[model samples]
Every structure is written in C-alpha cells, then in structure tokens.
Target: MEITNLETLPGKQIIAHFGLVSGSTVRAKHFGKDFLAGLKNIVGGELKSYTDLLNEARDEAINRMLNQAKSKGANAVINVRFSTSSVAQGASEIYCYGTAVKVS
Candidate 1:
C-alpha cells in the first residue's frame, strides 16, 4: 500500500476515507543493551543499541498500521505520523497513526 505524510497523496485522488487508524507496540530495553548503554553514557557517545531497538520498534508499529489500513479496504494511508512515550521505567510505547483511504 502507498503511504505519505502529507495531507493528501500527491497526484492521487482519495476516493474514500476510512477515518482514523492506529497501531502501537510497547518495547523494553534488553538487559545486556541497557548495561552497555550505561557504559556508553559514562563515555559520552551514541547508544547504538538503543537506537537500533527503537528503529526496529518503529518499523513493527508501522507494519501494524499498514495492516490495519489494508484490512479496512484502504489502498493507502495519508498524513501518517508517529509518536513515542515512556510507558515504564525501562520500556517505551511506539505509536503509529494515519487516515486510511482508497486512492486512485
């Protein structure tokens, strides 16, 4: 399915709109990675482990959002957006949302 962050899909007509759809996932930091991250913090550098974890979580959330859109008979999703929140001391929730639409 096609997806875009703009208000509308460029060069495509939105024939039908399916209102709002969302997907979310909660992820916790791995113990080993957390330990490594603590060490990295002491040295002052990028925490690649945390970065990789977040990226993977985001992708999973997006895939779930796309699946929702597809289930709704939508060929695309518009004005896509992502948000994150700390759900627990060691975990965070990744959220993805968009307007599902049929486009041509």
Candidate 2:
C-alpha cells in the first residue's frame, strides 16, 4: 500500500474514503542494551541502541498500518502520522495512523 504523510498523493485522486486505519506496538528496552546505553551516555555520543529500537518500532507500525489498509481495499493511505508514548518504565508505544482511501 502507498502511504504518505501528505493529505493527498502527488498524482492520484481519492476515489473513496475507507476511513481511519491504525497500528501500534509497545517495545521495552533490552537489559543488555540499557547497560550499553548508560555507558554511551557517559561518553556523550549517539545512543545507537535507542535509535535502532525506534527504527524497528517505526517499521513494525508501518507494516501493520499497511496491512490494515490492504484489508480495507485501500490503494493508499494519506495524512499518515506516527506517535510515541511511554507505556511503562522501560517500554514505549509506537503508533501509526492514516486515512485509508481508494485512489486512481
């Protein structure tokens, strides 16, 4: 499925609105990574662990959102957005949402 953060696709027209579709995942910090991250913080540089975690979360969320759009017979998803929130002391929720639409 095509997904864009814009309200509309560049060349396609929205033929039908399939309503909202969303996907979410909650991820917790790995114990080993947390320890490494603390050490990295002391060194004052990029935290690769957190970066990888968020990247994975984003991809998972997108995959789920696309699956939902496909299930709804949507050719595309417009106005796509991502949100994150703390679900627990070490876990975070990643959500992907968009308006599913049939396009031509």
Candidate 3:
C-alpha cells in the first residue's frame, strides 16, 4: 500500500475513502541500555539504542496500518501520521494512523 503524509497524492484522484486506520507498538528500554543512555546524557549525544528501537516500532506500526488498509481492499493510505508517547517509566508507544482510500 502507498502511504502519504499529505492530504492527497499528486497525479491521482481519491475514488473512495474507507475509514481511519491505526496501529501501535510499545517498547521498553533494557536496563543495560538505560545505563548507557544515562552516560550519553552527560555528554548530550544521540541515544542510538532508543533511536533504533523507536525506528523499529515506527516501522512495525506502519506495516500494521498498511495491512489493515489492504484487508479493507484499499489501494492507498492518505494523510498518514505518526505519534509517540511514554506509557510507562521505561516503555514508549509508537502509533501510525491514516485514512484508507482507493485512488486512481
């Protein structure tokens, strides 16, 4: 399925809109990784562990959202959006959402 963050895709007309679809994944930081992150915090550098984890979560959520659209016979997903939240002290959730639609 094609996914776009824009309201519409260029060179194509939306023939029908299905409905809102969403997917989410939650991850927790490992204690070992947390200690490394804490050390990195002192130097104010990128937290590679969290970065990789979040990227994976984002992709997983998007994949699930796309699967949902496919199950509904949608050819594309429009106005895609991603969000992140901390559900617990060490856990974070990544969500992907969009409007399922048919396009030509």
| Per-candidate TM-score against the hidden true structure | 0.96, 0.94, 0.93
Expressed as tens digits, the lDDT of each residue in 1-104 for candidate 2 is 78899999989989999999999999888799999988888789898888889899899999899999999999999999889999888688999999999998
Candidates' lDDT values, in order? 0.92, 0.91, 0.92
Q: Which ten contiguous residues of candidate 2 have the minimum total lDDT? A: 40-49
Instruction: State how far residue 21 of model 3 sits from its true place (Å).
Output: 0.7
Q: lDDT tens digits, residues 1-104, model 1? A: 99899999999998999999888999988799899888998899788988888998999999999999999999999999999999998798999999999998
Model 1: colliding residue pairs: none
Off by over 4 Å in 2: none
What's model 3's lDDT at 92?
A: 98
RMSD of each: 0.8, 0.9, 1.1
lDDT-best of 1 and 2: 1
Ranked by TM-score from best down, the candidates are 1, 2, 3
